[model samples]
Target: MPESPHPPELPARLLADPEMIGACRRRDFALVFRMVKKHAGIYPSMIARRCDLTPSRVGEVMAAKRKLLHMDVVERISDGLRIPGHLLGLSSRAWESPPELSAADWEPPSRPTEPPGAHSLPSHDVGDILASVACTSPRASTVQALRSSIEDYWRRDDQHGGEALRPAVIGQLRYVEILLMQSRGDTVRHGLLGVAAELARLTGWTHFDARQFSQARLYFGEALRFAKDIDDRQFMANVLACMSLQATYQDRPTDALALATAAQDHARAIKGTPRVLSMLSMREAFAHAVLGSRSGAHAAISEAHRQFERISDSDSDPAWVTYFNEYKLTVDTGIAHARLGEAEIAEPLIAQALHREGGTNQRGRAFHTFWLARTQLQQGKLEQACHTAVNALTPASAVASERVTGHLREFSRQLTPHRSEPAAVAYDSRLRQVLPAGVSGPPPP
Candidate 1:
């Protein structure tokens, strides 16, 4: 089949993938084809038609029965499929010639534009930074734009992982750091501090999701410092809560408890919205549950539920804390109960959120699915657990967060004892496809 006039273009994020780059470097077209099919939606037959090969040949190549080492065929795929020639180790393709070439005959080299959402400062930009610091103050509009970008980053992070946006965020954080030092007069600095605090906290979150513990803690501390400098108690409590969450994930439940307790205590002084208090109480509950303090955990959970009941339309929550709602509370409550060895109670709560969650947080859905599966499995419902666990892969497949990946891996480990069951076997077959290469499982022959 000949393709439509417009060929599919992989998103910049997918093209920037390290795995994709490695496959291209190794000339591993079978792997490359699989990745393209997975990410770009260009299947074997379409690939063959686009690259001027027989469908059977493309199938053979994908099945590893054939290889594409010939230069002419490689160039054909590059041009016909719009892959850059350099991606295949060849010289630049004809399409890459300035589109202006045919009409203008010649032209001077133009400034190269960075890929979308990317941020970096070249050596030449240092003077500009200093000049901006020395001359202009950040305007209200500029402050609003920064805040808006922070919100977008949060949404993007929730949908997937931090791999794609981390660079841009870190770049922005550095820029913010510079401004924080240079901007001195007026309420603008306070606003900038709040923004810096959030950006630093966000940067830390990206690292934490990737399992970079030390770096995560460092940024969390940096966030807290920025918050403290301005006496932003609510934001400080938020960062402490984040640190507590990280500690919980790192398996330091006692440390997590200390952090969460401190946050809860500090947040009380603000007597902020019920939503904020509910969130802190939940974080406290999580730590207590992890520490096996059933009484303490239950107490905190009760407080959280009570706070949730008091939430009103006019309640004011800091922008960052607005994501804490009844749905999230329910999910966390269930998870906390699970940690407390109450799977029977946990299962229903988790199942409700798993089915009712309306947001596009694929990673969150995957996390909930894993927890629900684990709870079901704990109750000896082997077949049901396997079915529920397998459903996680669909959502998990779309996100690259190490946290979600860790949940899937833990669920896999839990299923190890039942590996030979037919349901487990079925689940494993699909699971192996998405787990990163060189993970716990061996490479296929």
Candidate 2:
């Protein structure tokens, strides 16, 4: 017989117990499932494959939607997990006895502070192996696979806008959700939830970038739930920070402030990574700017700078946060200043950021370019502003970003007062020609 990829990781005593096998045979699945998860370390997806059952059927059984009454099914379960057949009321001769367990081997590892509803599998570090006398369980290869896929999609989204990858991302998210439901063991489950949270956050951010507010909010809420389930305070703060950014763009300063404050509270409570802390603080600064609180905005911006400086090369950033760097901070700070009518201060910072990371990110370039043009116009450089603003339309036309469209529309409206001027008329006509058809009327401020 082929060896199972997910061999039982439980101690020999638990595998020999009739009660455990009886639970599986009788289909008290939740009890059996938890025992399998805690003791065997075998995920349900693995079990379904071994038993030649569909994943949905296995889920139904686990969830109590279906019963495990058939003798053939019971036999399959016993054979699949390599459970001793006699315990499942099969012939004793039909199965080989599993290895015996010593009294010392029966003791479960100590995890006194394991949070309720959040299980953590044993750490993969060699220290864990050397520290415990217990046999090593199979490492969760699936977790690493999921994490790789998530990171891949994230990089794709960064290079190309989400429109090309959003559907595929959503599909991957749905698959991850299934894995989450099927997952067993604390470490494995928590890892799955972490991946889910990151994917949810990415999906939300993509939708937000595309100007699909409702979908973005839905995914953000979904991400928040997963983060909360695992009590991942840092990731929760990340999701809230994203929510705050969406609110700021939607012109809901009060909502933006509330969400940013909530994110900061989480960051403080957890003493989060410096990068994450900096991001939350930056969001807070933007919120303050939107609310027209100059002193508050400056205070938050200074804090953001401090937090960003605290991020050292040795500090490891989580996959979701590696994108937050000095260039991003500069752009964010400049936008906050620009939003508050500080054109002179905003222009240089924005221009520097544009000269740095803006070329690689079309969406980022479009956003900053429009703001640079706005700052120029604010400083009464009408001709220069018109030309710079026109340059932004190149990316705006190519990308399916609502923020870019909104910026173009706003620039056109700002030029309306100077409509009779040759430069303004030419810029206005260029904006109209560059914008996608049917996007008429004023856009969100």
Candidate 3:
């Protein structure tokens, strides 16, 4: 680890005082800096230079004008002040000598009352005598690594199936939860929770795709709680939209519409970015279509499109919702129309969407192809539907998604009435030879 650029000449008296550690744990940076100024005669500008932050930002934080603590900022402060990471609810700081803790310093202020299995595990000391291990303090780099890991797992879940990455994501969630519990300072605490919320939401999505509805709901709820705590309306609305989507998939149109509406209402109340508004409106369209409200659905979809049009790629947006685009809107519009039984309208829209972007998303291609096939079948184009369904199988087979399999199963059911037809016969034969088991096909290869 690199040495601090501006190590404070902290006196032994100040270092030994429990109040200083208590202030750190409480995230009283202003007080902490005041103490530094009093003892070491260092000014905030000097501190800012040492911490690699702009003087204005440091001044804002000290004056309590800025309360949002980011992980990078926390690392700078910890490194500069020579504070142990654990003192501020962080893991052990790798750069500095571990702070000496008396027995009184080791105990937490208080423990929350909770039933067995409901409480968090005890916090581990950096060098616990019982554990005989040295834990490094959490670094800004560590948070960045975790964010990258989550993104990789997300991409893996897209290409592969949730089952392949489920255990690992769950483990990551637990690890993040531990970090949230242990992290002290505002910057690190908020940053860890923000990342953890995203992880929870991703875990919930994987579970939902895997048909683990109960587990999916649990994680979504966790994500929502964290988002709420952080006052992140966009993330909170996003989670609600996910829940709405799950409800729509389960055929609970009323619940889906309610959730989506709640999301939209909250987004508006927060004056969220156009991208956020667009996402919520799109979700509302899905629910409206599911409920057989064609005009309402179309209106919501149009609003979504308008909101999306207002957003430019260069505009500042949250990382999670950056995937939204014109092509996605087209695909969603097609889905909404399909749900409303407008096959003719849906077919062209879906075809256009696939033509433009199908090559990029294997899972999405499988999903859209299944829908296109369904729409063809709805239009009585049995031969064309069979071909489309066949095109879907390869990507569907490559992924481990229960939702994709469900689509294939529904397609099979629609094919049953036409089974005696030559095209249907060929499809069945091909499906039986190629598709995974329990969906009227051979087991996955």
Worst 10 residues of 2 by lDDT: 115-124
Residue lDDT tens for model 3, 93-119: 656543564454577676453421212
Model 3 spans > 4 angstroms off: 1-136, 358-360, 441-445
Model 1, position 68, has a per-residue lDDT of 71
lDDT of 1 at 76: 69
Considering summed lDDT, which 10 consecutive residues are worst modelled in model 3? Answer: 118-127
Clashes of 1: 0
Q: What digit string (tens of lDDT, one per residue) describes model 1 on residues 182-285? A: 67666878888788888888988998988887778877887888888888888888999999998778555678889988887778887867888899999999
**Top candidate, metric lDDT:** 1
CA lDDT, every prediction? 0.79, 0.75, 0.76
lDDT of 3 at 429: 76
TM-score of each: 0.69, 0.66, 0.69
Off by over 4 Å in 2: 1-139, 438-445
Displacement of the residue 214 alpha carbon in candidate 2, Å = 2.7
| Number of backbone clashes in candidate 3 | 10
Ranking by lDDT: 1, 3, 2
